[model samples]
Target: MMGLENGITDIPYEVHSSEDLGRYLIAARDLMPGDLVLTERPLVFAPKALPDPEACMPCVGCYKPVLTDVGERCAKCGWPVCSGNCPGLRDVRHHAAECEVLSLRPDCVLDNMAEYYRHDALLSLRCLLLQKTDPENWKKLLEMQSHMECRTPGTESYDEADEFVVQYLMNNFINKFDGKLKKDVPESSKAILHRICGIVDTNALEIRLQQGTELLGLYSNTCVMEHSCIPNTKHSFVHSPKDKNDVFKITVKIVVPVVKGSHITTMYSHALWGTQARRQHLKDSKYFACKCQRCSDPTELGTYLSAMKCLGDGNNPCDGIHFPEDPLDDESDWACNKCKVKVSSSQVNMLISQMGEQVDNVQMMGGSVPTLENLLCRLSTFLHPNHYHIYSIKHSLVQLYGRQPNYMSQEYLDKKIKMCNDLINITKTLDPGNARLSLYRSVLQHELHSALVLTSKKANSDGSFKSDEDVKALLVEAKTAIEDALNCLKDDMEETAGKKLYAVIEKTKKEFEKYCKEKQLNI
Candidate 1:
């Protein structure tokens, strides 16, 4: 195997001897905290899904990734005015193109726009976005329509069609499966939509996704990441205003040591559950029987806190199954149900029929919806909180409660934030660059600031701008909330972090000015 030579060949790595693993010398590899393992071009670049886009606002003046719906246009020049008659996204060239398509069949425009945009936007808009970002690609993309143009015969649009296939294949076209040889595909199409198998090996790519997308989750597609029972990385999405891409971008980071040949993994979702529960989730989403080491173990490599003692007497849990007391235990011990013999983990598994009787009483769907609190309770009894299951469960508790501000009271809110703060400490050690964890901490801290405001306001006799002290305290709380939010999100400047900070700054500035204008505020 012609492996990658270390970039620093002049100063080779020092191979050290270790008594452990029965090895005289260990082959050491250097993977710095932020080493770039590999990055392939995006597999697919279709417009991201947008739900309930802002109204027809000219985006040119609004900035690259603005969210407002309406903008005005100057009627004289046929350009954007400001808010109301926002200019078309692009200048005349783009609008002229939109007009041509709308003109082809005026009736089709509305429906086409409706169908395209309802998931979030119209075809005209998607085209505009594509044009704005990659104008060259968009120009070439325009040629695609010629193949489908009304005057043209409905033949295989060889020219326009070729480019579409190429783009599609560039981002997808993995060959992990057997059979269906590349040579068997159409000759003309094969040249561009080439075999994508092993372009970036799936195993290594999973790790790469962890580093690149896990934190911000900025990129979506084959890169749409999933987590694992034993996760190697943690991630979250960051939304930024300065970004050219409109979609919320995700960022990620490694949370553990990933070795060569180890399948680098990230949890698609929370990994609070035991092996069975986690496997069922992947099975549902990815539709693959996880043969990963974690999934392969019935005990989940001893992480299955919920594993029951099928042959136990319910006391202290059980010493060894009492022979006559539990006939099932004896029966499974390579003997009769009433006979006495020790049982194996396999026997403990086969006797699972006894555990299912309780399943009918539980609300979880094949165990899909276990509460993190409950999972935590189980883990508390069976594993350490630092255990992967506990880590996942603890984070879930923080995320669920933190997001739903309306539901919890001051006391509950305090506890939730505290949990997240603790989680922050843990993540700092495990996944220091985990953006979601940072966002989670940011939210909790912001909420805590809210709680502080409420407390201060409660102490005041009346919520009014009457005195300097009242206004000062209120402004302080506002400033603190904005600062906490800004601090947590500052690292993720390219996405939501930037948008949120911009919003906070705007709000804080507006409030500060408003408060100064008032007589004196109490609340």
Candidate 2:
């Protein structure tokens, strides 16, 4: 029998055709929660940069040329520093929290990189750097990620608290550890703790905000984490504020209980469906016939046993799949969630074609607010969660919500901001530049600011609270949001999937930046 010794140590698992997932299965060992999973350095980790890329433009926090393809490494700390005015270098809050780790790992280089791992030679090395910086936290996070993944993904009580903690550590470490202390510790102790955290990204910024795909988890040795239809982990990319650079990291939450040997799975598809649909997805993309308990019920604990996303108005279009249906055509019709009836294929195709064209227009006319929204609603009707175009659509939507030019409503702003928040969790898998997301996030941020302003105005007439404090909060948000979008163009879209996408990202960044600066903002 092919047992653990016979090259089947990890139990039965299917590797997807899209990736070399099985390649990371380097050795046979009993998988455990918080086990030291395989870690490797990527062979190619260059940021997305176009020729004549924008040179370091100091980040708002410290007027330093945030390190990027064109930035520099600090003399004292290997951590990237922007330039002479780089406050990131002199920030006391950061120095003490970061120094010890920097002292221990002399050659430990925090790089802003992109690309795939061609080999495992540097896996141990990278892990060593992680271990050196914060062995306890790194070990804890990997374990948390593995253990929670053993539980189901979406069903568990969602907790943002744990997600934020893990996110704070990894993202900050990568971003050159520039986070201000969460608590108001004494300046001396804060410096010490900051040294412990080291120079890295605060994760205060992210390019992508989506959860890690099952496909990406394969990048780490922790693939043995159990599959949950709904996952606690979310992955994304961020550029270092200290030294401008873009690299992505995966984030996980401790909200779920993870038993050892359970394969961690995320709701790789959209969250709007039941177990059967999610299982079919797992089977198709991941190549695993999921025996997860949810699949046995198919309706996901009766969640979608009798529902439909598009069957209300008696226009049940292409709701279900027709065998031998053409992928290039369309499947944008509705199906009875209860009865399992679908619309005709021809009609579905018609809808899909219209939406696709709508998206193209938004991309073409990036500055148009109305056009972007029209494109978003149409795609939300068909595409699965984290679909590529959703990145483009959501980014546009977030921007529009902020600057409604007129008739800005607080209700829609709340709805749209939450929408971007959820979508960002999914985008972590699809878009790493966070810059791509910056545009959308900016919109949501602006809308939220508008809401606060409206609230302050209402409070003013009623004398409920101080409008100055409220206004400052609102103004800061608007600046942060706008800065996020500008950062993308400034960073030059230097992160992409393949070489072709990389080129496209850089080109878009440059042209967009040029387009904006020329428009001459009042600032």
- State how far residue 271 of model 2 sits from its true place (Å): 8.9
* Minimal lDDT window, size 10, model 1: 195-204
TM-score of each model, in listed order: 0.38, 0.35
Q: Candidate 2 overall Cα lDDT vs. reference?
A: 0.37
Query: What does candidate 2 score on TM?
Result: 0.35
CA lDDT of every candidate = 0.37, 0.37
Candidate 1's C-alpha runs over 4 A off are: 1-28, 40-44, 52-105, 108-255, 270-281, 291-438, 441-491, 497-523
lDDT of 2 by residue, 1-523 (tens): 2123223344432323223232222223333323322222111111112122233322222323354455665555443345545554454222333433343334523342311111111121222234444454344324322222222234221132123322333333333433332222212232222322121111111232121111111123233334444543333333333434212332322223335434334334444333434555654434455555444542333332212234334554544322212222223334444445556655644654565576776687674656666666666565543444565566566656645665346555665656666554553322333313333433343344344334433444445665555655654554454444344333333233322333444454454345435644222
Clash number for every model?
Answer: 50, 69
